[model samples]
Target: MTDLTGTSFEFPGEYYEIMRKDFRNLDAETEFLASLLPDAGTVLDLGCGTGSNLRALRERGHRGTGVDQSAAFLEYARAAGDEGISYVEARAEEYRTDERYDLVYSLFMTLNYLDRGRLPAVLRSVRELLNPGGQVVLEFGHLLNFVDSFQPNSVGHHRRDGVLITRLARQFINAHAANWRNEETLLVRTADGTVAMYDNFFDQAVLTGPEVRELLAAAGLTITAEYGGFRKEPAPFHGRGPLVIVATATPADTASDTAQQEENQA
Candidate 1:
Protein backbone atom coordinates (compact mmCIF):
# COMPACT_ATOMS: atom_id res chain seq x y z
CA MET A 1 0.00 0.00 0.00
CA THR A 2 1.94 2.93 -1.32
CA ASP A 3 0.73 6.51 -1.31
CA LEU A 4 1.07 7.85 -4.82
CA THR A 5 1.27 11.32 -3.46
CA GLY A 6 4.27 11.43 -1.18
CA THR A 7 7.36 13.54 -0.81
CA SER A 8 9.47 10.45 -1.46
CA PHE A 9 8.98 8.94 -4.90
CA GLU A 10 10.82 6.20 -6.73
CA PHE A 11 11.05 5.75 -10.45
CA PRO A 12 9.05 2.65 -11.34
CA GLY A 13 11.38 -0.09 -12.50
CA GLU A 14 13.59 2.53 -14.05
CA TYR A 15 16.49 2.19 -11.66
CA TYR A 16 16.41 -1.55 -11.09
CA GLU A 17 19.16 -2.68 -13.43
CA ILE A 18 21.20 0.37 -12.66
CA MET A 19 20.79 -0.12 -8.94
CA ARG A 20 21.56 -3.82 -9.16
CA LYS A 21 24.68 -3.11 -11.16
CA ASP A 22 25.73 -0.28 -8.88
CA PHE A 23 25.38 -2.45 -5.79
CA ARG A 24 27.06 -5.60 -7.05
CA ASN A 25 30.46 -4.56 -5.72
CA LEU A 26 29.12 -4.12 -2.19
CA ASP A 27 30.24 -7.62 -1.26
CA ALA A 28 32.72 -6.29 1.24
CA GLU A 29 29.95 -4.49 3.10
CA THR A 30 27.73 -7.54 2.82
CA GLU A 31 30.43 -9.79 4.23
CA PHE A 32 30.97 -7.36 7.08
CA LEU A 33 27.27 -7.37 7.91
CA ALA A 34 27.13 -11.15 7.54
CA SER A 35 29.80 -11.47 10.20
CA LEU A 36 27.38 -9.88 12.66
CA LEU A 37 24.76 -12.55 11.95
CA PRO A 38 26.83 -15.55 12.93
CA ASP A 39 23.68 -17.58 13.44
CA ALA A 40 21.53 -16.35 10.60
CA GLY A 41 18.01 -17.65 10.09
CA THR A 42 15.03 -16.13 8.37
CA VAL A 43 16.05 -12.55 7.56
CA LEU A 44 13.93 -9.66 6.37
CA ASP A 45 15.50 -7.27 3.92
CA LEU A 46 13.32 -4.17 4.09
CA GLY A 47 13.53 -1.84 1.11
CA CYS A 48 15.32 -4.55 -0.75
CA GLY A 49 15.64 -2.92 -4.11
CA THR A 50 16.53 -5.45 -6.83
CA GLY A 51 17.16 -8.09 -4.12
CA SER A 52 20.89 -7.61 -4.03
CA ASN A 53 21.24 -8.09 -0.29
CA LEU A 54 18.90 -11.05 -0.43
CA ARG A 55 21.33 -12.65 -2.84
CA ALA A 56 24.07 -11.99 -0.35
CA LEU A 57 22.05 -13.59 2.44
CA ARG A 58 21.36 -16.72 0.44
CA GLU A 59 25.05 -17.08 -0.25
CA ARG A 60 25.60 -16.96 3.51
CA GLY A 61 23.13 -19.80 4.27
CA HIS A 62 20.15 -17.70 5.37
CA ARG A 63 16.59 -17.78 4.09
CA GLY A 64 15.92 -14.26 2.86
CA THR A 65 12.82 -12.31 1.84
CA GLY A 66 12.91 -8.89 0.27
CA VAL A 67 10.28 -6.16 0.16
CA ASP A 68 10.19 -3.25 -2.24
CA GLN A 69 7.62 -1.03 -3.95
CA SER A 70 9.12 -1.19 -7.39
CA ALA A 71 7.13 -3.58 -9.55
CA ALA A 72 9.82 -3.43 -12.17
CA PHE A 73 12.46 -4.25 -9.67
CA LEU A 74 10.42 -7.16 -8.34
CA GLU A 75 10.01 -8.47 -11.85
CA TYR A 76 13.75 -8.52 -12.28
CA ALA A 77 14.25 -9.91 -8.80
CA ARG A 78 11.81 -12.72 -9.41
CA ALA A 79 13.63 -13.73 -12.53
CA ALA A 80 16.88 -13.46 -10.59
CA GLY A 81 15.54 -15.35 -7.55
CA ASP A 82 17.37 -18.50 -6.48
CA GLU A 83 16.32 -21.57 -4.49
CA GLY A 84 15.54 -19.80 -1.19
CA ILE A 85 15.02 -16.15 -2.06
CA SER A 86 11.57 -14.51 -2.17
CA TYR A 87 10.59 -10.90 -2.69
CA VAL A 88 7.53 -8.85 -1.78
CA GLU A 89 6.74 -5.85 -3.91
CA ALA A 90 5.28 -3.42 -1.42
CA ARG A 91 6.14 -0.26 0.43
CA ALA A 92 8.53 -0.85 3.28
CA GLU A 93 6.38 1.11 5.72
CA GLU A 94 3.26 -0.96 4.98
CA TYR A 95 4.55 -4.46 4.17
CA ARG A 96 3.37 -7.27 6.46
CA THR A 97 4.69 -10.81 6.49
CA ASP A 98 3.05 -13.80 8.16
CA GLU A 99 6.42 -15.25 9.17
CA ARG A 100 8.69 -13.77 11.81
CA TYR A 101 12.37 -13.28 11.09
CA ASP A 102 15.48 -13.88 13.16
CA LEU A 103 17.07 -10.75 11.72
CA VAL A 104 15.66 -7.66 9.95
CA TYR A 105 17.65 -5.17 7.91
CA SER A 106 16.99 -1.82 6.30
CA LEU A 107 20.29 -0.76 4.88
CA PHE A 108 21.84 1.70 2.40
CA MET A 109 20.08 4.75 3.77
CA THR A 110 16.69 3.39 2.81
CA LEU A 111 14.96 4.52 6.01
CA ASN A 112 16.01 8.10 5.52
CA TYR A 113 13.65 8.35 2.56
CA LEU A 114 10.77 7.64 4.94
CA ASP A 115 8.95 10.38 6.81
CA ARG A 116 10.32 11.09 10.25
CA GLY A 117 6.93 10.73 11.90
CA ARG A 118 6.42 7.36 10.27
CA LEU A 119 9.77 6.00 11.49
CA PRO A 120 8.42 4.80 14.82
CA ALA A 121 5.74 2.83 13.06
CA VAL A 122 8.33 1.37 10.70
CA LEU A 123 10.55 0.29 13.59
CA ARG A 124 7.56 -1.13 15.42
CA SER A 125 6.79 -3.14 12.34
CA VAL A 126 10.38 -4.34 12.19
CA ARG A 127 10.22 -5.37 15.84
CA GLU A 128 6.92 -7.13 15.35
CA LEU A 129 8.24 -8.92 12.32
CA LEU A 130 11.16 -10.31 14.30
CA ASN A 131 11.28 -13.03 16.96
CA PRO A 132 12.30 -12.20 20.49
CA GLY A 133 16.00 -11.31 20.67
CA GLY A 134 16.02 -10.76 16.92
CA GLN A 135 18.27 -8.00 15.69
CA VAL A 136 18.02 -5.22 13.08
CA VAL A 137 20.92 -3.68 11.22
CA LEU A 138 20.19 -0.14 10.01
CA GLU A 139 22.59 1.83 7.85
CA PHE A 140 22.39 5.49 6.85
CA GLY A 141 24.38 8.61 6.22
CA HIS A 142 25.97 10.44 9.11
CA LEU A 143 24.34 13.86 9.41
CA LEU A 144 27.35 15.31 11.20
CA ASN A 145 29.50 14.40 8.22
CA PHE A 146 27.43 16.62 6.01
CA VAL A 147 27.70 19.48 8.47
CA ASP A 148 31.45 19.12 8.82
CA SER A 149 32.18 18.63 5.15
CA PHE A 150 30.19 21.34 3.45
CA GLN A 151 31.00 21.62 -0.21
CA PRO A 152 28.75 24.15 -1.90
CA ASN A 153 29.00 22.06 -5.05
CA SER A 154 30.96 18.97 -6.02
CA VAL A 155 31.06 16.45 -8.85
CA GLY A 156 32.15 12.83 -9.19
CA HIS A 157 31.94 10.16 -11.86
CA HIS A 158 31.83 6.37 -12.00
CA ARG A 159 31.09 3.70 -14.56
CA ARG A 160 28.47 0.97 -14.45
CA ASP A 161 27.89 -1.31 -17.41
CA GLY A 162 29.60 1.13 -19.70
CA VAL A 163 27.37 3.89 -18.39
CA LEU A 164 29.16 6.89 -17.00
CA ILE A 165 27.44 8.32 -13.92
CA THR A 166 28.22 11.96 -13.24
CA ARG A 167 27.00 13.20 -9.90
CA LEU A 168 26.71 16.88 -8.96
CA ALA A 169 25.93 17.55 -5.33
CA ARG A 170 24.99 20.84 -3.71
CA GLN A 171 25.03 21.65 -0.02
CA PHE A 172 22.85 24.02 1.97
CA ILE A 173 24.49 24.75 5.31
CA ASN A 174 22.64 26.82 7.91
CA ALA A 175 22.47 26.99 11.65
CA HIS A 176 20.74 23.87 12.94
CA ALA A 177 20.14 22.64 9.39
CA ALA A 178 22.41 21.20 6.73
CA ASN A 179 21.03 20.03 3.41
CA TRP A 180 22.93 18.05 0.77
CA ARG A 181 21.18 17.77 -2.57
CA ASN A 182 22.52 15.50 -5.30
CA GLU A 183 21.77 15.61 -9.00
CA GLU A 184 22.91 12.56 -10.91
CA THR A 185 22.84 11.80 -14.61
CA LEU A 186 23.85 8.57 -16.26
CA LEU A 187 25.14 8.52 -19.81
CA VAL A 188 25.84 5.33 -21.68
CA ARG A 189 28.37 5.88 -24.43
CA THR A 190 28.10 3.32 -27.16
CA ALA A 191 31.12 2.31 -29.22
CA ASP A 192 29.68 4.32 -32.06
CA GLY A 193 29.22 7.44 -29.92
CA THR A 194 25.54 6.82 -29.28
CA VAL A 195 24.37 7.73 -25.74
CA ALA A 196 21.52 6.72 -23.44
CA MET A 197 20.48 8.99 -20.63
CA TYR A 198 18.59 8.75 -17.30
CA ASP A 199 17.86 11.17 -14.49
CA ASN A 200 16.68 10.82 -10.87
CA PHE A 201 15.93 13.02 -7.87
CA PHE A 202 16.53 12.12 -4.21
CA ASP A 203 15.70 14.14 -1.10
CA GLN A 204 15.59 13.21 2.59
CA ALA A 205 14.84 14.69 6.01
CA VAL A 206 17.86 15.24 8.24
CA LEU A 207 17.91 13.47 11.61
CA THR A 208 20.81 13.45 14.01
CA GLY A 209 22.14 10.32 15.75
CA PRO A 210 20.40 11.09 19.03
CA GLU A 211 17.17 11.72 17.18
CA VAL A 212 17.45 8.38 15.38
CA ARG A 213 18.24 6.62 18.66
CA GLU A 214 15.21 8.19 20.31
CA LEU A 215 12.98 7.12 17.45
CA LEU A 216 14.22 3.54 17.69
CA ALA A 217 13.73 3.54 21.45
CA ALA A 218 10.18 4.80 21.00
CA ALA A 219 9.61 1.90 18.63
CA GLY A 220 10.55 -0.50 21.47
CA LEU A 221 13.92 -1.58 20.06
CA THR A 222 17.14 -1.32 22.06
CA ILE A 223 20.27 -0.08 20.36
CA THR A 224 22.95 -2.65 21.11
CA ALA A 225 25.71 -1.65 18.70
CA GLU A 226 26.27 1.63 16.85
CA TYR A 227 29.20 2.05 14.51
CA GLY A 228 30.56 4.49 11.95
CA GLY A 229 31.39 2.21 9.02
CA PHE A 230 30.04 -0.99 7.56
CA ARG A 231 32.98 -2.70 9.25
CA LYS A 232 31.45 -1.86 12.67
CA GLU A 233 34.11 0.61 13.66
CA PRO A 234 33.29 2.72 16.72
CA ALA A 235 31.58 5.97 15.86
CA PRO A 236 32.93 9.15 17.41
CA PHE A 237 30.47 11.44 19.14
CA HIS A 238 30.39 13.63 16.01
CA GLY A 239 32.00 11.56 13.29
CA ARG A 240 30.65 11.46 9.75
CA GLY A 241 30.29 9.30 6.60
CA PRO A 242 28.20 6.11 6.84
CA LEU A 243 26.76 4.83 10.13
CA VAL A 244 25.61 1.34 11.00
CA ILE A 245 23.17 0.83 13.88
CA VAL A 246 22.47 -2.57 15.37
CA ALA A 247 19.31 -2.86 17.45
CA THR A 248 17.55 -5.83 19.07
CA ALA A 249 13.84 -6.41 19.37
CA THR A 250 12.11 -5.23 22.57
CA PRO A 251 8.47 -6.13 22.92
CA ALA A 252 6.07 -3.22 22.80
CA ASP A 253 3.97 -2.43 25.93
CA THR A 254 6.33 -4.17 28.36
CA ALA A 255 5.55 -1.65 31.10
CA SER A 256 1.82 -2.31 31.05
CA ASP A 257 2.35 -6.06 31.27
CA THR A 258 4.86 -5.66 34.07
CA ALA A 259 2.40 -3.58 36.08
CA GLN A 260 -0.36 -6.11 35.47
CA GLN A 261 1.86 -8.96 36.62
CA GLU A 262 2.85 -7.03 39.78
CA GLU A 263 -0.83 -6.45 40.68
CA ASN A 264 -1.62 -10.14 40.15
CA GLN A 265 1.35 -11.16 42.31
CA ALA A 266 0.29 -8.66 45.01
Candidate 2:
Protein backbone atom coordinates (compact mmCIF):
# COMPACT_ATOMS: atom_id res chain seq x y z
CA MET A 1 0.00 0.00 0.00
CA THR A 2 1.20 3.49 -0.70
CA ASP A 3 0.50 6.56 1.37
CA LEU A 4 -2.90 8.04 0.53
CA THR A 5 -1.17 10.82 -1.35
CA GLY A 6 1.48 8.46 -2.65
CA THR A 7 -0.78 7.83 -5.65
CA SER A 8 0.46 11.30 -6.52
CA PHE A 9 3.79 9.67 -7.39
CA GLU A 10 2.70 7.98 -10.68
CA PHE A 11 2.73 4.48 -9.22
CA PRO A 12 0.34 3.00 -11.78
CA GLY A 13 1.33 -0.61 -11.26
CA GLU A 14 0.45 -0.49 -7.58
CA TYR A 15 -2.61 1.72 -8.06
CA TYR A 16 -4.24 -0.41 -10.74
CA GLU A 17 -4.10 -3.47 -8.54
CA ILE A 18 -5.25 -1.62 -5.45
CA MET A 19 -8.16 0.02 -7.21
CA ARG A 20 -9.23 -3.19 -8.93
CA LYS A 21 -9.27 -4.91 -5.58
CA ASP A 22 -11.03 -2.15 -3.69
CA PHE A 23 -13.52 -0.75 -6.17
CA ARG A 24 -15.19 -3.85 -7.51
CA ASN A 25 -18.55 -2.76 -6.09
CA LEU A 26 -18.64 0.44 -8.09
CA ASP A 27 -19.24 -1.22 -11.43
CA ALA A 28 -23.01 -1.35 -11.10
CA GLU A 29 -23.05 2.20 -9.79
CA THR A 30 -21.08 3.49 -12.75
CA GLU A 31 -23.38 1.72 -15.15
CA PHE A 32 -26.42 3.27 -13.54
CA LEU A 33 -24.84 6.69 -13.86
CA ALA A 34 -23.81 6.20 -17.44
CA SER A 35 -27.35 5.29 -18.35
CA LEU A 36 -28.51 8.77 -17.42
CA LEU A 37 -26.46 10.49 -20.05
CA PRO A 38 -27.31 11.03 -23.71
CA ASP A 39 -25.49 9.04 -26.39
CA ALA A 40 -22.30 10.61 -25.10
CA GLY A 41 -20.34 13.24 -26.94
CA THR A 42 -17.71 13.80 -24.29
CA VAL A 43 -17.52 12.30 -20.81
CA LEU A 44 -15.22 13.94 -18.28
CA ASP A 45 -14.05 11.85 -15.34
CA LEU A 46 -12.71 13.91 -12.49
CA GLY A 47 -10.13 12.24 -10.25
CA CYS A 48 -9.86 9.42 -12.69
CA GLY A 49 -7.26 7.18 -11.06
CA THR A 50 -5.89 4.56 -13.42
CA GLY A 51 -8.90 5.50 -15.54
CA SER A 52 -10.62 2.30 -14.52
CA ASN A 53 -14.06 3.89 -14.39
CA LEU A 54 -13.35 5.82 -17.56
CA ARG A 55 -12.37 2.63 -19.34
CA ALA A 56 -15.49 1.00 -18.05
CA LEU A 57 -17.58 3.82 -19.49
CA ARG A 58 -15.76 3.59 -22.82
CA GLU A 59 -16.47 -0.13 -23.01
CA ARG A 60 -20.12 0.84 -22.77
CA GLY A 61 -19.72 2.83 -26.04
CA HIS A 62 -19.05 6.29 -24.69
CA ARG A 63 -16.00 8.43 -25.38
CA GLY A 64 -14.16 9.25 -22.16
CA THR A 65 -11.64 11.83 -20.96
CA GLY A 66 -10.05 11.92 -17.54
CA VAL A 67 -8.69 14.63 -15.26
CA ASP A 68 -6.56 14.07 -12.20
CA GLN A 69 -3.90 15.84 -10.21
CA SER A 70 -1.59 12.87 -10.16
CA ALA A 71 0.94 12.64 -12.95
CA ALA A 72 1.61 9.04 -12.12
CA PHE A 73 -2.05 8.19 -12.48
CA LEU A 74 -2.19 10.04 -15.77
CA GLU A 75 0.84 8.15 -17.10
CA TYR A 76 -0.71 4.89 -16.13
CA ALA A 77 -4.07 5.82 -17.63
CA ARG A 78 -2.39 6.74 -20.89
CA ALA A 79 -0.83 3.33 -21.20
CA ALA A 80 -4.04 1.45 -20.39
CA GLY A 81 -4.93 -1.03 -23.12
CA ASP A 82 -7.07 -0.15 -26.15
CA GLU A 83 -6.27 3.49 -25.81
CA GLY A 84 -8.34 6.48 -27.06
CA ILE A 85 -8.91 7.86 -23.56
CA SER A 86 -7.54 11.39 -23.10
CA TYR A 87 -6.06 12.14 -19.70
CA VAL A 88 -5.23 15.57 -18.30
CA GLU A 89 -2.93 16.03 -15.32
CA ALA A 90 -4.17 18.86 -13.18
CA ARG A 91 -5.79 19.57 -9.85
CA ALA A 92 -9.60 19.28 -9.72
CA GLU A 93 -9.77 22.96 -8.84
CA GLU A 94 -7.30 24.24 -11.44
CA TYR A 95 -8.13 22.15 -14.51
CA ARG A 96 -10.56 23.44 -17.12
CA THR A 97 -11.77 21.99 -20.39
CA ASP A 98 -12.45 24.17 -23.40
CA GLU A 99 -15.34 21.99 -24.47
CA ARG A 100 -18.24 21.04 -22.26
CA TYR A 101 -19.15 17.41 -21.84
CA ASP A 102 -22.40 15.51 -22.09
CA LEU A 103 -21.58 14.06 -18.70
CA VAL A 104 -19.16 15.14 -15.97
CA TYR A 105 -18.64 12.56 -13.30
CA SER A 106 -16.65 12.50 -10.09
CA LEU A 107 -17.04 9.16 -8.54
CA PHE A 108 -15.95 7.42 -5.31
CA MET A 109 -16.14 10.42 -3.09
CA THR A 110 -13.56 12.43 -4.99
CA LEU A 111 -15.41 15.61 -4.11
CA ASN A 112 -14.49 15.20 -0.46
CA TYR A 113 -10.86 15.91 -1.34
CA LEU A 114 -11.65 19.59 -1.43
CA ASP A 115 -12.53 21.63 1.61
CA ARG A 116 -16.01 23.16 1.89
CA GLY A 117 -14.80 26.47 0.53
CA ARG A 118 -13.33 24.87 -2.52
CA LEU A 119 -16.49 22.96 -3.35
CA PRO A 120 -18.33 25.91 -4.88
CA ALA A 121 -15.48 26.53 -7.26
CA VAL A 122 -15.20 22.89 -8.18
CA LEU A 123 -18.96 22.61 -8.73
CA ARG A 124 -18.93 25.70 -10.89
CA SER A 125 -16.12 24.26 -12.95
CA VAL A 126 -18.12 21.09 -13.47
CA ARG A 127 -21.10 23.14 -14.44
CA GLU A 128 -19.04 25.15 -16.90
CA LEU A 129 -17.61 21.98 -18.37
CA LEU A 130 -21.03 20.47 -18.92
CA ASN A 131 -23.15 20.86 -22.00
CA PRO A 132 -26.54 22.39 -21.41
CA GLY A 133 -28.85 19.78 -19.92
CA GLY A 134 -25.80 17.63 -19.25
CA GLN A 135 -25.65 15.52 -16.15
CA VAL A 136 -22.95 15.25 -13.50
CA VAL A 137 -22.79 12.20 -11.33
CA LEU A 138 -20.94 12.64 -8.05
CA GLU A 139 -20.39 9.81 -5.62
CA PHE A 140 -19.15 9.85 -2.03
CA GLY A 141 -19.30 8.03 1.25
CA HIS A 142 -22.08 9.28 3.45
CA LEU A 143 -20.65 11.03 6.52
CA LEU A 144 -23.78 10.39 8.54
CA ASN A 145 -22.85 6.73 8.69
CA PHE A 146 -19.74 7.53 10.68
CA VAL A 147 -20.98 10.48 12.71
CA ASP A 148 -20.93 8.46 15.93
CA SER A 149 -17.47 7.08 15.52
CA PHE A 150 -14.49 9.14 16.57
CA GLN A 151 -12.17 6.22 15.96
CA PRO A 152 -11.34 4.24 12.82
CA ASN A 153 -13.42 1.84 10.73
CA SER A 154 -11.62 -0.97 8.97
CA VAL A 155 -12.76 -3.90 6.81
CA GLY A 156 -11.71 -6.11 3.88
CA HIS A 157 -9.39 -9.09 3.48
CA HIS A 158 -9.10 -10.66 0.06
CA ARG A 159 -6.44 -12.70 -1.72
CA ARG A 160 -4.90 -11.61 -4.97
CA ASP A 161 -2.39 -13.59 -6.99
CA GLY A 162 -1.28 -15.63 -3.95
CA VAL A 163 -0.98 -12.52 -1.82
CA LEU A 164 -3.33 -11.86 1.08
CA ILE A 165 -4.15 -8.17 1.48
CA THR A 166 -5.91 -6.66 4.46
CA ARG A 167 -6.94 -3.06 5.01
CA LEU A 168 -7.30 -1.03 8.23
CA ALA A 169 -8.64 2.49 8.26
CA ARG A 170 -9.40 5.13 10.90
CA GLN A 171 -12.19 7.66 10.68
CA PHE A 172 -12.20 11.18 12.08
CA ILE A 173 -15.55 12.97 11.95
CA ASN A 174 -15.97 16.71 12.06
CA ALA A 175 -18.78 19.15 11.32
CA HIS A 176 -18.40 18.95 7.57
CA ALA A 177 -17.95 15.21 7.08
CA ALA A 178 -16.13 12.11 8.20
CA ASN A 179 -12.51 12.28 7.27
CA TRP A 180 -11.63 8.67 6.50
CA ARG A 181 -7.88 8.80 6.27
CA ASN A 182 -7.12 5.21 5.47
CA GLU A 183 -3.63 3.81 5.74
CA GLU A 184 -3.75 0.71 3.53
CA THR A 185 -0.41 -1.07 3.94
CA LEU A 186 -0.12 -4.19 1.80
CA LEU A 187 2.15 -6.83 3.23
CA VAL A 188 3.06 -9.92 1.27
CA ARG A 189 4.58 -12.64 3.44
CA THR A 190 6.12 -15.45 1.43
CA ALA A 191 7.53 -18.90 2.06
CA ASP A 192 10.99 -17.63 1.17
CA GLY A 193 10.73 -15.08 4.01
CA THR A 194 10.25 -12.26 1.57
CA VAL A 195 7.87 -9.44 2.53
CA ALA A 196 6.67 -6.47 0.50
CA MET A 197 5.03 -3.33 1.82
CA TYR A 198 3.13 -0.49 0.19
CA ASP A 199 1.58 2.43 2.11
CA ASN A 200 -1.17 4.54 0.57
CA PHE A 201 -3.60 7.07 1.92
CA PHE A 202 -7.20 6.51 0.83
CA ASP A 203 -8.80 9.58 2.26
CA GLN A 204 -12.46 10.37 1.56
CA ALA A 205 -14.86 13.15 2.42
CA VAL A 206 -18.27 12.22 3.80
CA LEU A 207 -20.97 14.83 3.48
CA THR A 208 -24.55 14.88 4.65
CA GLY A 209 -27.22 14.59 1.97
CA PRO A 210 -28.26 18.18 2.49
CA GLU A 211 -24.70 19.39 2.27
CA VAL A 212 -24.28 17.71 -1.08
CA ARG A 213 -27.53 19.08 -2.44
CA GLU A 214 -26.61 22.54 -1.25
CA LEU A 215 -23.16 22.38 -2.78
CA LEU A 216 -24.52 21.42 -6.16
CA ALA A 217 -27.31 23.92 -5.92
CA ALA A 218 -24.89 26.70 -5.17
CA ALA A 219 -22.97 25.73 -8.25
CA GLY A 220 -26.06 26.21 -10.44
CA LEU A 221 -27.06 22.61 -10.72
CA THR A 222 -30.11 20.64 -9.65
CA ILE A 223 -30.06 17.32 -7.88
CA THR A 224 -32.08 14.70 -9.69
CA ALA A 225 -31.41 11.70 -7.52
CA GLU A 226 -29.30 10.30 -4.68
CA TYR A 227 -28.59 6.68 -3.84
CA GLY A 228 -27.20 4.83 -0.88
CA GLY A 229 -25.38 2.23 -2.91
CA PHE A 230 -24.64 1.48 -6.55
CA ARG A 231 -28.00 -0.18 -7.06
CA LYS A 232 -29.77 3.15 -7.30
CA GLU A 233 -31.46 2.54 -3.97
CA PRO A 234 -32.72 5.33 -1.82
CA ALA A 235 -30.18 6.83 0.58
CA PRO A 236 -31.75 6.50 4.00
CA PHE A 237 -30.29 8.43 6.92
CA HIS A 238 -27.93 5.50 7.52
CA GLY A 239 -26.16 3.34 4.96
CA ARG A 240 -22.87 1.75 4.06
CA GLY A 241 -20.58 2.46 1.14
CA PRO A 242 -21.04 5.62 -0.91
CA LEU A 243 -23.72 8.16 -1.77
CA VAL A 244 -24.41 8.51 -5.46
CA ILE A 245 -25.85 11.83 -6.60
CA VAL A 246 -26.98 12.71 -10.11
CA ALA A 247 -27.24 16.38 -10.92
CA THR A 248 -27.68 18.42 -14.07
CA ALA A 249 -26.36 21.83 -14.90
CA THR A 250 -28.99 24.60 -14.92
CA PRO A 251 -29.08 28.07 -16.34
CA ALA A 252 -28.53 30.94 -13.94
CA ASP A 253 -32.15 32.07 -13.76
CA THR A 254 -33.56 28.56 -13.60
CA ALA A 255 -31.20 27.72 -10.76
CA SER A 256 -32.58 30.30 -8.33
CA ASP A 257 -36.07 29.24 -7.34
CA THR A 258 -35.66 25.49 -7.55
CA ALA A 259 -32.52 25.49 -5.44
CA GLN A 260 -34.07 27.75 -2.84
CA GLN A 261 -37.06 25.44 -2.58
CA GLU A 262 -34.79 22.46 -2.01
CA GLU A 263 -32.76 24.29 0.61
CA ASN A 264 -35.81 25.42 2.53
CA GLN A 265 -37.32 21.96 2.41
CA ALA A 266 -34.09 20.25 3.39
- Report lDDT (CA) for all predictions: 0.69, 0.69
Q: Model 1's lDDT to the true fold?
A: 0.69
Give the local distance difference test score of model 2.
0.69
Model 2 residue 191 lDDT score: 43
Q: Point out the worst 10-residue segment of candidate 2 by lDDT.
A: 1-10
RMSD of each: 5.2, 4.7
Q: Give stretches of model 2 more than 4 Å off.
A: 1-19, 148-156, 172-180, 188-194, 256-266
- Where model 1 places Cα greater than 4 Å from the true spot, the runs are 1-25, 38-40, 149-152, 168-181, 190-193, 251-266
Q: Candidate 1: minimum summed lDDT over ten consecutive residues — where?
A: 1-10
Candidate with best TM-score: 2
